[model samples]
Target chain A: MKIHGSISKTASFRTTNAVFIGRSIRLSLRNAEALIMAIMLPVMLMLLFTYVFGGSIDPSGNYVNYVVPGIILLCAGFGSSSTGVDVAHDMTNGIIDRFRTMPIQSLSVVTGHVVASLARNLLATAVVIGVALLVGFRPSANALEWLAAIGVISLFILTITWLFAAIGLVAGSPSAASGYGFILLFLPYLSSAFVPTSSMPSWLQGVAEHQPITPVIETIRGLLTGTPIHDSAWWAVGWCALILLLAILWSIVSFNRKAGRR
Target chain B: MRGNVIEVKGLRKKFGHQIVLDGIDLAVPTGTVYALLGPNGAGKTTLINIMSTLVAPDEGSVKIAGYDIVTDKNMVKRSISLTGQFAAVDEMLTGEENLRMICRLSGLTVAESNVRTVELLQHFDLTAAARKSVKTYSGGMRRRLDIAISLVISRPVLFLDEPTTGLDTISRRALWKIIDQLKERGITVFLTTQYLEEADQLADIITVIDEGRVVATGTAKELKSRVGGEVIELFNDKDDLIRTVSTTGSIHDIRQKLNELASIVSPELRVNIRKPSMDDVFLALTAKEMERSLS
Candidate 1:
């Protein structure tokens, strides 16, 4: 794969893709009611869990601290469903064909959807975190660790968003994108997210131990607890990297197939 | 040979066992409106898709604005825009936002996008409903907005696949005027239409496709001339009128004396010499295709 052209040309593709993604984010924000509604889901989840389920979970010390990171990660993961919906809406509405004929980069369309989800995810995450602090949740780690935590979660959300966008492209309708959302919500619940896997059934424990969500939740938990970083962080990063790569590959393949038929 | 902006040679496409376009060739010169006339499922959309670079050909090559569609895709895309049979516009966004987004996609800067959006809104006469969400707009308004978005990039070549499919007479004429203005700016317009008068009004050349192959290609007059100089339907009292018509060499037994005459003219002294319309030629060509297939 010769990238082709001079340095300026390479820079131009990145610039064009970024601008396109920025426009998508603006459009997403313009729908104020929908944006607010989407953000409310994660915040509501945090509040409900802290008030209702926090007493039962045993994670040493305050349950809010242990539960907050998991909820934030859940927000990042499930928040991407709307991105899939947007892409599906574009497909059903006949907008994708117009983009196919343009001079824009191939990845720009998927990136725009992913970035739009990222922007919304981050906003929702911030609202959830702020609400968490208000109700008594604090990280023992320093500023650098907090930033690192954010970086990991952002990457996680972006990767999942791309996968959902691909699923959205293949989905029959916008509402079906939310059907995938249910499966996303199941991951955090089944993993060692809100509770210890020791309390789970012997058969269920196998699932909680091996699922990708376990490592991700454990890694974020380790970071906020200021515990000595474990191999789980590396495992979480590796799993995210693999999923992102597969999703990127699948997106390009589906895009090409759609393009061929046009 | 005549500074053609689009040249398609032996183009072909297929979906599994179904062949869509089979060895069809066409050339459209710069600043000319070439109307591809076909009935439903006649592969007109497939041809436009291939030419617009939305779809790739199974065989043959397409050149648009002197750029090969496959090898020079970006350059080809830079010079052309397509409005397919379905008007593609975002219902959530206002008509103006749709146009502005297209400008941005075309690589216009922020300031340039604003200017282009305003210009397109005014040109499409969509300025009044510019702020209205497209979901609230009428079908005509949405269709008009779709076309206006295509122009924001100001490409030299434009493809419209049945632009006036389900429009009222008034809306159809409005679209025609916009197309005429585009041609005045020296844009090469390639369109496909089922409405015969549309091709008659707009096309410099018309190509008829049937069963995914070019059955006929020429100017409207050239094609019409092929059937006959004039068709005289007589309501004569004479039972021997058939003989009277047959002697003139212009009247062939269309129902029975089925020799295909390339061109016909009545040699009668009082011959009515009215030129045939494109509609008549199209009907004849498609009828022949049906007849051939049935046999």
Candidate 2:
């Protein structure tokens, strides 16, 4: 057979990415239980906090509105964490070797999981928002402010999704990847997701006010509820940008190392 | 090494402190079936991985289809298909979907991908199970599907790493038939296996490796000849091998030995003449290596 000198042009970047993304989404759809659980866990948490603990946390019954943004962020966190498991599963399987021998960019598989996670989280966020409205949420934001809140939420989802993808590439197995991702999920609970940071112990308040998730949650709350954003928006964007950058770099390094060693 | 589809010179690789491939050199000619015959841990997989550009060699140059494996990796990838030891199929996707996925990844249009997928499913006898998930496939079906996936793009070279391993006899023969078909299509096949009968049946040239080194490389006939001449065996009524005697396989030598055995031993013993099979060659060659190393 006549072999050509240039054959890498056969697979374009767009088609390669499209194929992988379609695969990831199809796999997620087939695994309907995981998708439902991701949405259900955060929705269940929103209900628990608004009805069960809202009275003790706040005398007024405005807890639904107060907790919706946190639930959205938590919804995103829950959905994106599966990226770790998916990526780890792919890495540990035989298919990666087939992908490596192909004429396309191998890491498109990782990109597929990240994009799928982002898509799944957005859907879960919408569901959680709908549930919050059905209960008692009444945000005062107009269309532009709502758009801003969505941008922040999507940014947060993208950031953590990439971080989780990196964790998947670094982890030895799917279980280990989820274990690492689970520890980071605590960031949402420790932030101003459920209660005011001031009510926290002075020592704990230092952590609540300073961590990355708090600023992001504060920014979304400000845009949605007309609360003063102060410099939290800038801090939120800055922290997400930094983490996104590090996570991407970490993913590349870990992927290359594992690919070579395997 | 002339007009070879795959060429390697002094290829070396190591994982941590363990050396997997030690200065190995090989050449696989175009439109031929070459077999790498060795036992487990013989570095057969490592060599395939390095040639396929999945792993880098520390000290070697590999050229596949006239493209450097390291410098022009994508070009090399475009010229080859690797069906690994374990079936590398996605268990979650249906057989048809998995085939289409590779077709699309290989730059086929959606229409072309669909046609190709349908053709492959029928060709590999997977049409009835086309819509079923691959997780439910039998071992032979998965292996056939894995090979079918490799053929989606029509490259010049195919690498089968122990293709018949873990397969039943019927599946193994079915795969051998497929290999014969691939040969008729003039696809250069590089397969690795520990089965001497497989190498004997399928390969045009066989290279035997032991402990990360090439111990022998020749045609099946040449390897059998290397084990000396025919062997004479004596068995008792229970059909157990009593003893074997080496021979030059001449008519006179055989007659004299059989007469002497009949006179000194019992006539009730069965006498059988055996030609040197691939098994004898493999054992003799490997034993020689062991002796050399021990000394």
Candidate 3:
């Protein structure tokens, strides 16, 4: 075949990024084990918390509404960790080396994982929300409030997905990456995701109230229940932006260092 | 160097305290197959990596298709494609999808990418398995797909690092045929291999590296000549048929020795003279180096 004309840099860059994104999404979906991990925990936890502990935890008797926001945030956090495992697999499997040798944009590899993780997290969140709705969870959210909640949740997914993607690159193997996921999965447990922060001992309460996940969950709950977002929404946004910036910077640095070696 | 597609000067690299490639140099002319022959840990892959710009050299420079490896990396990338030791194919994707992804990444338009993907699948004899996931592919199919992906961009130079390391004989021959076709299309191929037969069969010029240094460089015949003169093979049921004889003198003296041997041994013995193969040359050169190092 003839050597066709070379594509312009901008066009090539966009096409490469699109191809990586599509490939990553397809691969992630086809990975049955990772898909089960991403979906199973959130569904199981929603059922357990709504049915087993609802009466004692929420004496006011609307625990489904109380736990749905928390479970959505938890699902997002857990779903994003799978991005780490996927990235680790890519790094160890020599595909990253192939990509590095190609003429495509370097950042597109990481960007593709980030975008795919976000898609996965959003899907998991929807699944949890659907289960919650089936279990009699209702929110008095208006269209604008629901839009705002989605924006906040999307930002949270973006931040956590990037953070774990970097963690995956630093990890030596896929199993090691899953080990790192434990920290992320357990963070929601200590946060206000399951119970109000004040119910904990004073020292634990401080951490549960102030960590990034708590404010994010609190903001989503307020947005859904028509409560004033107040400072918690801004704090959640700030945390997402700060974590995203740091994780992206770290991912680039680690990826370059790793890719430079033989 | 003027007509070379790949030129290297004093290239050096080391991993920590161990020297992998010690002040190596190479020059490959356009449209020729150049083979780098080495034993394991002789730094063949390191050299290929440096030339492909996958790993930077500790010292010296490389020019690919007239573009500096350090300063003109994008141009070097535009000119060369590397199929590494591992197949480097995405196991999760189907063979067709893998080719399509590479084509699109290489800047082909939608229709062009589709056509090129199909053409490459057919060329590599992977059309039947095109729809199957690479995870289910055999080692040979993965290797063919890897080379096919590298060819998606149609660069002037291609690097194959131990491309046939794990393939069966049939697959190895299939790959060699494909490589021959590439040469016919004027594509310069730079391959690193431990198989002496592979180098002898494919390379127009072969460089043998041992213990981080190039031990010898030349055509297969030239290398054999360096080790010694022509070998005489005598076939007989008796034990006295094998002999090593020098050929430093005139043809008259050689004829006299052959006649003398015929008179002494059985007249029924069959004698033939032939050049040494690459295996002999490689063993002789490496053994000499080993002895020198031990001393």
Highest TM-score, which number?
Answer: 2
- Cα displacement (Å) at residue B267, model 3: 18
Q: For model 3, how does the per-residue alpha-carbon lDDT over A1-262 read when each residue is reduced to its tens digit?
A: 5554342221377788899899889988898787778888999988999889988998777898888988998888888988898888888875677788777786688889899989888888888888888998898999999999999999999999999999998998989998987788888899988888889999999889889998898899999986566799989999999999999999998887777452
DockQ of 3: 0.41
* Cα-based TM-score, every candidate: 0.87, 0.95, 0.91
Q: What fraction of native interface contacts is shared by candidate 1?
A: 0.38
Q: Which residue pairs clash in candidate 3?
A: none
| Best candidate according to DockQ | 2
Error of 2 at B242 (Å): 3.9
Q: How high is each candidate's interface RMSD, in Å?
A: 8.2, 3.8, 2.7
How would the candidate models be sorted by lDDT, starting from the highest?
2, 3, 1
Question: Once superposed on the true structure, which residue ranges of model 1 sit more than 4 Å away at CA?
Answer: A1-11, A57-61, A227-229, A260-262, B231-277
lDDT of 2 by residue, B15-106 (tens): 99999998898989998999999988989999999888888889989999899999999899998888987788998999999999988888
**lDDT tens digits, residue span B46-100, model 3:** 8988887778888989999889988988778778888988888899999999989
lDDT per residue, candidate 2, A107-198, as tens digits?
99999999998889889998998898899888889999999998999899999999999999999999999999998888889999889899
Compare candidates 2 and 3 on lDDT and give the better one. 2
